[model samples]
Every structure is written in C-alpha cells, then in structure tokens.
Target: MKFSITTLSALLLVSAASVAQADSYADAIKSWCGGLAVTAPKTSTVVVAGAKTKITVTRKADERTKTITGLDLYSVSKDGKAKYVQNVWKGNYALKSSATISDAVPKNVPAGLYYYRVWVTNLIGKQHGPDCLETSRTFKVTTGSHTNAAGDLEYTESLHDNSIYNPEHEVGCFGLSVDYPKAGDTFKLNQHIHIQANRDAASQTDALTKVELYKGDQLINTAWTGSESFQNSFSLKDHLVLDNADTTSDYHYKIHATSKKADKTCVFKSGDFKISN
Candidate 1:
C-alpha cells in the first residue's frame, strides 16, 4: 500500500474542526478563553506500532500564564479520517510556553499512515477553547513483528566499507551508485539517486525477496523477485529522479528489505539519508 503526507492547510482544517467541537461544550461554561492557539509538531514522525510516543503541545500565550487542565489526543487515518483516541493528560498545570504528554499506540493498531492532534482545556474554568488545537504532521506506524532468519544486511556507496564474503558469515550487501548520502546532505535540482541490493539465498526457491525505497510513509520504489530465486544470490536496483523546481529544501530517503515465503516474512530497515534538492 502507498502513503501520502497530510498538507499543512488540511491539518489546520482538522485542528479547526476539533476546536469547533470543543467550543460547543465550552459555550456551556462561563470561564473559557475566546481564542486559543497551538503549534503543530515540527516534522513527520515514525514509530513502531504498540509503542509510546512523547508528544509536546505548545500553547501560544500572549501575556497571562495559561493554566492547562488537560489535553486530548486524536488520531487520523491515511484516508483523511480522524478519531479521538484518548486523553493523554488530565491534571492542573501552568504552561509558560508548552506542556508535554505521553500517549500509547494500541497494540492492535493496523500498520499504516496516521497523524495526531492535540486539544487543550483550562483547569480552573473547565473550558475548552475552540481555537486551541494543533494537528501534527503525518506519521507512520510499522508492524513490530517483521523479523525473519534470512540474514543480516548492509548498504554501501561503493566497495569502500565492504569485507570479503565468507560462506560461514556474511550473506549479502546493498550499494548506491552515488556517494553515500549523509543524514543532511544537500543537493541541487535535477539530481537523482540509484541503489541496488545484493543478497544470497539458501537455495534457488528458498525465499522471495523485495526491496522498498520510501520517502516518509510514501513508497517511492519497489524491487521484488518472483518464485524463482538465485542458487547463490540475487540483486535488485532502482533509480529515483529528483525535482527541479524546489531548490531550498532537501529530500530524505529510507530503504527497507523484505523477504517472504509460505512459512514466514522478514524485514530490515536502513537508517534515513538526505539529499539537497
């Protein structure tokens, strides 16, 4: 399945909707701020399913110290559907700048794209401000059981960081045609990337292997093998074309490998890299 990032405008609308709902309840109370503002999370986040994520909510205050009573967290799906997951925090707290809360992703959460937003309430007044809501950038949740006994894997820009293969030890490696891009490498427009993964299977029909290249939750490229497997090993490669119009920003990449058979499925993920664009 493919994934897409939620746009900033859409997130704002989602936040507004949350505040609108909260406002209806706030109107019944006497002590409620006319407006409230919150800042969204800085960047997209990725977490393993069934894990706890630390979420910080910054309430934009003008002069007075705002007393935060509680914060409600909401989860949104890839199809632009949103639901109230739970209240992460419920207590009296003063927010000079911001407050943080912890939320746990349910163990049964399906592996897919999701986003989160926060809504705050006043402790003393018991009022929820319609304007005090912020939606975070799109995030991803990966299933935790993607382990198999295929073999350990590695990636290299060239033959630089490679060791001589021994039948008793290492099984395979991946390589990129371009220089090993660092975490924050900047690239000019019109640049592109090419990568390949080479691995040896136990037998010709032992495993069905596939390689995936992702930019955040979105799957950019995939390379897979059929029922036929290499007697010793096989390789998969692909290229990614860069955009030209956007010059001030960089692009991040993550590579993952998966092998599946009738019996089981295994997965490996590489650290993220960045390219200037």
Candidate 2:
C-alpha cells in the first residue's frame, strides 16, 4: 500500500529497458505478431500456502505467428525485473497466429522468491528475448494459524494444486480443502475469498471455490469471485475466504485441488490440504 523506492525503482527501470530491445520473439507481443507460452505466473518454483493468490500466464500464438493486432502479455518473476511484470490483456485476451492465451495472475500477491518471462508483440505490447524462464520452485505466500480440535483458531490456506480440467476428453484431477474461517480471529482485510464453484450450492457440498488467505506459504489476500462463472465453479482451486484473519498471523490450512480440467488455472493443483500452523 505504499510505493516510493524511487517509484518502485522507476518501475524496474521502465520494465527492464522495455524488454531489453525487442527484435524477434514476435516483437515482444503487446498484441498481434504472436508467440508466447508458459502456463502460469510460475515457470518453475511455485509454492503457495495461502492468503489469496492465483497467477497464471499461459498464452500460445504461433500457428504462423501473426494476427493479434491487439491485447497480449505474459510475464512471471523471481524479482522478474524485466519490470515487475503482469499484464495479461486487461481487456480480456487477444493475439493471432494460431492463438492461445491464459490470464488471471494478479490478485493481491506479495511474498518473495520468484521468476518468469514471456514475449509477444501488440495489444499490451513488448517483445523479443524477454521470452526467458526461471522458476523450478521458489514461491512464497506466508501466514499461519491452527488449533481446531475445538481450541478454536482456524484461519488457514495452503496451495500447490495442479488439476487440469475438461471432464471427458480433458481428464485431469487433483483436489483439496480445509476451509472454515467464516470470520473471527481478528481480521480487517474486507473480504475476497468466498468461493462456491463445481456445483454452486447455497447450503454446501464443498462448493467453496477458493477465497484465499495464508501466512506460512504467503499470499496476503484475495476473496473476489464475481465472474468466470463464479471463477470456474471450483476446478483447480481458489475462491473462499470465510475464516477472516490479520493479527500477527495464524495458519493450519491446506487445500490443494488440481485438474485445471485442462488448464483453467493449473500452476499446481492435483489435491492438497493441511492446517496446523
């Protein structure tokens, strides 16, 4: 909520010299031109324990490469200086030449240890070698709290789900859960983790999407699911925040669900859950 380190270091030096220079890499796609792939805000090291986090960056455009004429972006990080990235066609999604792009990797993220780089050239523009990649695992989203045997204190969140979804033709499965913080343990964040996907029930049946909230694996906050059909109605994970927390820290959460059906948001979700901070 504050920025001055020379305006975030001149926003990382005009985003790493504006993508180093852009010659090929589909002109470092801001839109059309084409070329970019690497599913997720993770190129390698990705470990999230909880507090609202979902960073995906999968965009593929190289059927001949060129035809976007609008919207495009993909960049992850580990201090991804190419100017602290994240641009996924804020307008929705665009880019030609055999097209392919996945968005939604920006939601109150603030833990350290990261790495990633992608390139395209139009819509949001910036191409060439930024096509870099690095991150075989080094992601954090800390926060912790656990003591539920009736001891109360049950504010938790744990991530690492890789469930690619599709149903029959795109069979991928990995699920997880440990949600129960409807509100109590000192919170002031407002709210953003109120999930209810997969079946979209009003009573209950594990339809808590994945609101997000953690300390040990670090993901400061996130509980907004107004769209994406309730953010996918529960596929990979993310969209539930009822526990409510913010004091000193509390954790003991582990809910990892993966399958992504086929990639709705599959960074790592094949099933996960644990809450004991």
List pairs with backbone clashes in candidate 1.
Answer: 186-276, 187-276
Error of 1 at 183 (Å): 48
By lDDT, who's the top model here? 1
Off by over 4 Å in 2: 1-36, 39-112, 117-182, 185-256, 259-277
lDDT of each: 0.42, 0.32
TM-score of 1: 0.35
Best by TM-score: 1
Tens-place lDDT digits, model 2, residues 159-239: 332221112211222222223333233323322222222321111121233444356577645432322222123322232
What's the lDDT for residue 241 in model 2?
Answer: 38
- In model 1, the runs with Cα more than 4 Å from the true position are 1-43, 122-131, 145-277
Q: Pick out the ten consecutive residues of candidate 1 with the lowest summed lDDT.
A: 167-176
